[model samples]
Target: MLAGIVSAVLAALVFGGVAAPAQADPLPQLATIGSTLYSFGDASLCAGAIDLALEAAPHHPGHVLAHVTPRGYLGGPCGNQVKLGWVGSAGLQTRDVYVYADAAPGETITTDLWVGTGPAKVMAIAWPIRSTFAEWYLLVP
Candidate 1:
């Protein structure tokens, strides 16, 4: 009976009757500048918040920012309802800053960031409340 059940399951999968598990999309490539490594992608964190993470050299000091761009019609204005913030190691976090999207689809809204102490692992989160489509980049300078 076990063999029969296994065979049935295999047949269902082979015949496309059973749906395969969805694969998570790959994160964006990381960029390096003078020793800092920065990257951004869609992150599914706790409480349904999609966030981005940045890893920098430990013991070094640097600054970061979020360049958020909203997706929409070619000539229409994009939404201006995103919350930008960063969380660092040792439970350090910066206050959230609200930013509005630019009128152009590719135009970006820049949010300045203050990262915590070094050997640091920081996560920059961009939560869009009113926008349907958006992309963000965590930049180090």
Candidate 2:
């Protein structure tokens, strides 16, 4: 009888809808402050300084100059004069900015400096080619 009871309990436990323990989500590496986003990969290097600057930007709705780096880039200075565009509910504004290699550390290859109020949508445009570009969204603060 004891063995039968043990078997019955085991069966109930096994067939029941009890779920396993839940898992924790992975932590993000990017550092965000208010409406601004900053990435400082390998905090031990110059990126730390840049990240600090991004964090200190004024918290307001404005047009920002973003620095973007190309993918799979190995080394060297990543600065180039690129045409950038900002799109918001108002309209689209195109301008030029210097895109550097070591801009945003880890999150994405893009970083920004608040220039003025116009639009939140920002991107890097390749001139002449006109076919390739990279984009990022800025939240209004």
Candidate 3:
């Protein structure tokens, strides 16, 4: 009789009585908006964008330049000259910045602008020849 009771208890524990703990979905590693790619560092602000960024760079290198922007604003010309500077090295480095606005949950929008190697220069081609570029993340909040 005792053996039968012990077996029933064991079966209940192994089969279905206790509920498994719920876990949140893993954070994403990459995000892409148009031709641009966004790579995130360990201290990334948003989780969803991280996944998108990773998708953009599956086998990314150690040093990369990421530009994040909204969906419709990519075609616009630079308002002023922006210049960024950075030292190139062989170590792995990531720079993540929020562009435009904070990404709300379930809000799907093109938030990544572009990714590149080395510094970026944004030049405005006009009468006087205005040029701009900068190091680090561009158009970030």
What is every candidate's alpha-carbon RMSD to the true fold? 15.6, 14.3, 14.3
- What lDDT score is found at residue 80 in candidate 1? 31
Candidate 2 at residue 140, lDDT?
38
Q: Please state the error at residue 88 of candidate 2 in Å.
A: 1.7
**How much lDDT does candidate 1 score?**
0.38
Clashes found in each candidate (C-alpha, N, C closer than 3 A): 2, 2, 26
Which has the greatest lDDT?
2
Runs in model 1 lying further than 4 Å from the true structure: 1-60, 73-76, 89-91, 94-106, 119-141
Q: Model 3: C-alpha RMSD to truth?
A: 14.3
lDDT of 2 at 104: 38
Candidate 2, residues 34-73, lDDT tens digits: the string is 2222222222222221211122133334434343433211
Query: Which scores greater on lDDT, model 1 or model 3?
Result: 1
Residues 32-63 of candidate 3: C-alpha lDDT, one tens digit per residue: 22232232212222222211221222234232
lDDT of 1 at 98: 38
lDDT for each of the candidates?
0.38, 0.40, 0.29
Taking all chains together, the TM-score of candidate 3 against the true structure is 0.20
> What lDDT does candidate 3 reach at residue 69?
40
